[model samples]
Target: MKLSYPVHDIDNRLLLPAGTELSGDVLEDLISSNHTTPSQTLPLLEHGSVRKDIVKFISQPPYQLIFPEKQDISKLLKQMEKVQFVLPFLRSLDYFKQYDFTTYNHLLNVFALSTLLAGDLIPDYEERIRESAAGPAHDFGKITVPLKILKKRTPLTRAERDILDHHTLAGYVLLSYYKKDPYSLTARVARDHHERNDGSGYPRGINLNDRMVEIVAVSDVYDALVSLRPYRPISYDKRSALEEIVGLAEQNKVSWDVVKALIAHSRTDKPHYQEVEIPSEKRGAPPPGNVYGIIAEETDADASGTSE
Candidate 1:
């Protein structure tokens, strides 16, 4: 088959340009390859199903507390559907659905929460929509990490933890490459969501400045804290989760306004965003080591084992 568009790997390497003929052998190789978009679009996420899932998620607790109004939900749903048309986003979702359902579920939750929070934080409907694309693809870099590490039931060793932490950098590069835009909001969110405002977060440990990044960062942390993880023996209850987030705000690790927006949802009373007393001492991040070779250096023993 001839191609209408050029094909690139997740790293954005040009594998086959437009008008390249695909013999049967080439087609087979392409199908067997991971992280490469196929010549033709396969079945992407159905708009109806995604809309249904988003609606159901928001109807539940905590999410139900600060759900958007009817008009805003309609607008948000439309924008989400628009994201499915982006090849990289679609491919990333597809990959997660097939290989990592846990991340896929997390993706859907973050996708709904980030966009909902955006509606509250961002006044302009268009900007909210643009930022909506960031959530679904925020953890797209995890596709490079082995499933064994991601789904490990026990604690990770220092080396394994290092590799897991590299997902941020991996996602950042892959997202930027996927969109062919270095400064894309999705890529930035993937890169910076782990970042704290106090410079205590990972990868760069730089303070987060982007509002979109801030919104997703709060959503990502909240969901992770509240949801059950293999490493976490018990998921945090709603109030406890919010308290921890509020504490982070007190520590200047996250934006107060963004945190308040999240807190506002769980309450019937109007949320007031007053300055929480900042801590006298701020925590510092350690200098980053060379994680570029961590994954490549993994051994079979490490892959099959867990650590505390």
Candidate 2:
């Protein structure tokens, strides 16, 4: 396989230039190389030109709505400015930006929302920084998924759905095994964000107790619900989207505290958990069904149980 852009080592050194053929042996050599230190991308992310662009993006219309309070946005920006950027995180973001820009934008939205939510949910500063960076990279495995499946204007077949669901495991392996990320938390979030408290999520059906993983999970689903898709024209409104997540919380699929943090950001009135109630009759398609219809046999085990 060949990449559209250049590939960099963990030290920000060039490993392969644009259009370089990536043979199996070459990939093995790159992955096996001993480069475990943090990448130089940290300074670039914190004090570079990208920081300015991020400031502009989060301050705009839709993202601005996520942080209604200016002080909240200011606090998040301060925290982001001190974050430590890693090689796999940068490489993953670059791949998404070049191949699938829609997913890239969605990741940015997730990063913004997750960081904001972290301030309220995660009390520790170091953990907050980790959560902020992990947000955009949570779907890093999606880069392995074909662009056609990602941009399909119709329902996914059983085979196609299987490929899509494998991204979580793929991402974990890429970051943990191949890239050898020093911070294991990022790799864990990549694997566990799709997991649920009730053991219903895909790739791995284990119960998730990690708050950072849960934060990313909530942000991931909320963005999927509210964002407009090419296949599905109209997305759920803010209130309806929150209600859908709340319904999941009621089912014990996700954490109430994480969901409530999202509600506080999105809802201006009655954002408290006690006031937020599941609708008598749930609206919209249920989970991945609502995001994109799936066409597969009910008995297909691999495709049977995938959540957002």
Top of the candidates by TM-score: 2
* Runs with alpha carbons beyond 4 Å of true place in candidate 2: 1-62, 126-128, 177-179, 269-291, 296-308
lDDT of 1 by residue, 1-308 (tens): 34434545555565556575545465444444434443332222363255676677776665666664677567667666655434655666667667776687788889877876776777795644766778877887676566777876655656677657767766665555555555678878887888999899987789998888898889988888766666665666677777778778888999888888777666666455343332345343212331222334456787566332
Model 2 weakest lDDT span, ten residues long: 299-308
For candidate 2, lDDT tens digit of each residue in 187-216?
678878999999998656889868888999
Q: Which run of 10 residues does model 1 get worst, by summed lDDT?
A: 284-293
The TM-score of predicted model 1 comes to 0.72
- Per-model TM-score versus the true fold: 0.72, 0.74
Model 1 CA deviation exceeding 4 Å by range: 1-48, 68-72, 125-128, 270-300, 303-308
Candidate 2 CA-lDDT value: 0.68
RMSD vs true structure, all candidates: 9.6, 7.8
